[model samples]
Target: MGAAWEPGGAGVLALPSGRLVRGRSLRALPPGPPPQFALYLAARPVAPAQWESRWLRWLDFRLPADPGAVADALREAWQRAATERVEIACAGGLGRTGTALACLAVLDGVPPGEAVAFVRERYARRAVETAGQRRFVRRFGGLATNDPSVAE
Candidate 1:
């Protein structure tokens, strides 16, 4: 449950329930299979040093003005969360981070329509605090809500 999110593109944070919430740096693809579970955040242009990574696979891209990365991350997150793993997606915590959280919320059984509010209330009061980011959350795929009305 309660875990401090370290500053980075995205990472895997272990929740109190022993779940792994993975964070990732939003970039392009390198032609390969996506991670087991992940959440992507589409933010502004990233510098070269931001591109630097040793362990996680780097999806090469200057930056993002789209939701491709977020979608991929959400897909992974959904798979992991289904197994009761703690999945997280963040971009400096707040805007992009909140947006990714909202997507994760949807994957965690929150209604696609109310995913933004769900993330904001549970993850952060300031989650997805932007029009563009909100839009991304609304459209993101990959979800597993417990609410029968919204479950898929």
Candidate 2:
């Protein structure tokens, strides 16, 4: 029940540490086995899935509403990626999903400044869409994660 995703599979992003996490669009999910765990980024929590999932309050093209929770959820996703099929998803899967993937890159020891690029090169070229999203990824490393503001 803990088989990880195949490295380089569809939507799978291989981190510097070799951990793999998939980023997908909730609206157009890929054809494959369901992830063992998923982190859903949307304005409202998604309906429960066959596998375990955690829904974060995130709006499209915006940073997470709770930075600390984002950190924790990403850490959990990263940890599970070691031995489980973990996926990050949003409605369109480019902005919020990509931003979260970049944050996961940061957690995996890629410098925050380079994390967005890392994800774009490996995941999606147009990832982390907005300036605020990019700013959030840039500051993810230094911020306290709790009570940090990324507005405007």
Candidate 3:
């Protein structure tokens, strides 16, 4: 499977495994066809039915997503990114979206401590807002599998 839309520039990061995914705001979806897989993080249930979607019940502009669920979702997203157009989105597309992208970076063999910076450098300068969100990315490697490259 190929991506429905190829990411031209920022908002997309390439993993060490050669998988690519995009991070964006739910309110600022890139112009083109909808992604093959859309992972949404929000306080309330606002996930659209227009595409294959997974909603993590995360509080808007807050830290701490259900760690277990997030790990699972990130793993799934990582695996699917190999063959599908995967997107991670949140309200502002900076906080939660950035955190998730950082986690995915870890899964791609980026050190946990550097994952946030990696995403911010490639995705957005403001990616991964808040100290708690940064901490989450730092500890994400331990919460998930031992091998960051392999998704369970």
The number of the candidate with the highest TM-score is 2
Model 3, residue 100: displacement in angstroms?
0.3
Give the worst 10-residue stretch by lDDT in candidate 2: 143-152
lDDT of 3 by residue, 33-126 (tens): 6678888899887746687889998886676457778888999999889888889999888999999999999998999989998987888889
Residue 34, model 3: Cα distance from true site in angstroms: 1.3
Clashes of each: 18, 0, 0
- How far residue 119's Cα lies from its native spot in candidate 2, in Å, is 0.6
TM-scores, all models, native as reference = 0.49, 0.91, 0.88
TM-score, candidate 2, is: 0.91
Q: Candidate 1: where are CA atoms >4 Å away?
A: 1-66, 82-91, 142-152
In order, the Cα lDDT scores of the candidates are: 0.46, 0.87, 0.82
lDDT of 2 by residue, 1-152 (tens): 24877777889999988888999999876877889899999999898899999999998877788788888888889899998999999998899999999999988999989999999999999989999998888888755344356322
List, residue by residue over 1-152, the lDDT tens digit for candidate 1: 22323312234433323344444334433232234433334333333332222122222222234344345545555455545333333344556656666666655556667977765555556666667667656655432222233221
Give candidate 3's TM-score.
0.88
| Superposed Cα RMSD, model 3 | 3.8
Using lDDT as the measure, the top candidate is 2
Misplaced by over 4 Å in model 3 are 4-10, 146-152
Whole-model lDDT, model 1? 0.46
**Candidate numbers, best TM-score first, in rank order:** 2, 3, 1
